[model samples]
Target: MPHTLIRIDDLEDPRIAAYRDIRERDLVGRKGRFVAEGKVVLNVLFSTARFAAESVLLRENRVPGMTHIIDRIPPEVPVYVASGDLMDAIAGFPMHRGVLAIGLRSEEEPAEALLARLPSEALVVALAGISDHDNMGAIFRNAAAFGADAVIMDRTCCDPLYRKAIRVSVGAALKVPFARGGSADAVADTLEAQGFQVLALSPSGKQAIEDVERAPRCALLLGAEGPGLPEALLSRLPSVRIPMRADFDSLNVATAAAIALHRLWRPPTL
Candidate 1:
């Protein structure tokens, strides 16, 4: 096992440039991968062999529940320990939960690539403008648990692979295959061309989600919290609504998507 000790006093040392501008990845441009904070998030990440942690940062004394997590990492992987302040300086945040990790950025994937991997039995979730990281993350968590095939999103949606989205999803975002780009209409055009029906989610939509016949191929189109589906999308695609309490304005987009997916996409009994 190899060990490299970094002192808290040397905060500006450039040995680890990747740890400095943590927020740069939040927007866009030539940024590195997302950071997974805390032991709980890292523990969730342990299941994903696809994500390789470039490094792990830990507090000197260590977190209570994370001793097992540290043992799971390969002996050769770089693990840095610092006092709380030092940990924050490296991580660019104050809440240096006794441990942290840098999760590898996922490779860019195309919708066609995702489409090709589909089994005859596949269920997928579609999201648009779900710019809120927490919502995007929660939706992914639910999708992974319920057996959804993929998450399709427009370019405007937040990066599902971003740090916060991954943390919020407990890293379920990584497990789910997602493709971003193209408007609902464009994605619909491609999906339709691929023989999928674009079921647009909306409140007043005439068709109920349960009423729709499940097909071997289907895409669930979702919008952000308040804007609802793009007006043009409704005109071009078949609009469907989840049955809900009439008095409520609407369910949160992630929750609504979960309910609809469960009802529409239950795997057939063998």
Candidate 2:
């Protein structure tokens, strides 16, 4: 197959506008769209029906498996090949695997959806104000590993679909169901309405995580390292502490989510 070439000398080509200004993806911005970089993440996105490709950018010359991936995409999906230098410049970053794709943005369900859809028994990880993209990605990865049914985050939290988070997550964010949190009051009200036990993880807590009685549904609310859960969330939920080494005050958010998910959630015997 002859290579399909795209020349994008003008950075403002509307066809590839979604790939421009990669840094702005983290901030609150216009419509939702996510760029999956590298063949691995791009392939993962490609395999999913939930995410549809807006366009694809690839480097020219000896790109492997180009035929296989292209066949998977419908002809309607736009494919553009460019020089390796142009690929990097258009993406505003280095091309790790010499391939990148822009996909339609999607959001995780809200708490109500998670609560209603979750089986009679469910384990969920709720994140509040975890601003770091790497941490957000790691949280989803851990959530997927330990059988957490859903991930809930605050509105102020970083966008999980952003490029960095998607890379760090290695596409686990695509698998784990998540919801944006509304407000501390809203979180408490929703949990109370759903009858889920909200166990907020914080050092100031009195109860050990092991001691908490497991319910049919539970959500572990984790916060960023320093600020911890906001005061309102603390005041609302029953606080539980994860017993850690005295020398170390806390684990990384991802590790803590993993440990919490493991201790609290395990698949039932088939």
Candidate 3:
């Protein structure tokens, strides 16, 4: 079904209010809503059943190129178009990409519930204290690239649904299944309870990543750079380190995750 396009000429229109001053509102909570920007992210927003499009705001000229994506929007969702000047004013920025949408996230699912749904053979990413949006996004992108079944984040981690994070992930954040909430230890506990062999990544880990054996159900535990995983948590789990140059002992959390995920990921047999 085709999406109805609404024309807006005025800046004060209440219908586009959620899109106003997007840069300022990016940090402030959007309740259950989030801004999905760029053509690529919009594609995932429309393609995924994990999220629903509440509405879309596009530059009038960009509409000609967006029919394929627009067609994916449900008939009830509105697609609004405006002039470049009006879009710039509404977003408080250049609005160069000329694409944006309000995506609604459903109720948060429990970590236990999300883990329970994974297959008997699964690879999952568990994150702790990952406060940087860029790293969070890159990690999700890597997870999608490496075929990890899901991503589980602890309470201290930043929101993957953040506009910058989602944009950085190139929509992988929307495509990959994830669950948030709980302490780092609590997250580890849940993964273990679901039959996952929790492997913590840190510079001082007892074993090198290449030497570790793969488990049928595995969760790669990663933490923020510099501080890395909690020392206590590291002590409790099977820790693995990515070997580097003689003096260098660390890798960025996201890069480390990619290496570990690649090392552990086995291509599914036909």
**Candidate 1 RMSD to the correct structure:** 2.8
Stretches > 4 Å off in candidate 1: 1-9, 13-15, 21-30, 267-270
Off-target runs (Cα >4 Å) in candidate 3 are none
What ordering of candidates by TM-score runs from best to worst? 3, 1, 2
The sequence of per-residue lDDT tens digits that candidate 2 reaches over residues 1-270 is 443546555556787777765666546554767777776677677676767777887787525676666667656678877777776777687765777787777665667877787887888888878999999998988887788888877777888888788888888777777777687557656766787888898877768878888788888888887888888778767988889888878678788777778889867799
List of clashing residue pairs for candidate 3: none
Candidate 3 residue-wise lDDT, 53-170, digit = tens: 8899999999999999998889889999999999999999999999999999888889899999899999999999999999999999999999999999999999999999999999
lDDT of 2 at 212: 82
Model 1 lDDT per residue over 111-153, tens place: 8678767886677787778889899999998888788888888
Runs in model 2 deviating more than 4 A are: 1-14, 24-30, 65-71, 107-109
What's model 2's overall lDDT? 0.76
Q: What is the C-alpha RMSD of each candidate to the true structure, in Å?
A: 2.8, 3.2, 1.2
Better of 1 and 3 by TM-score: 3
Clashes counted in candidate 3 amount to 0
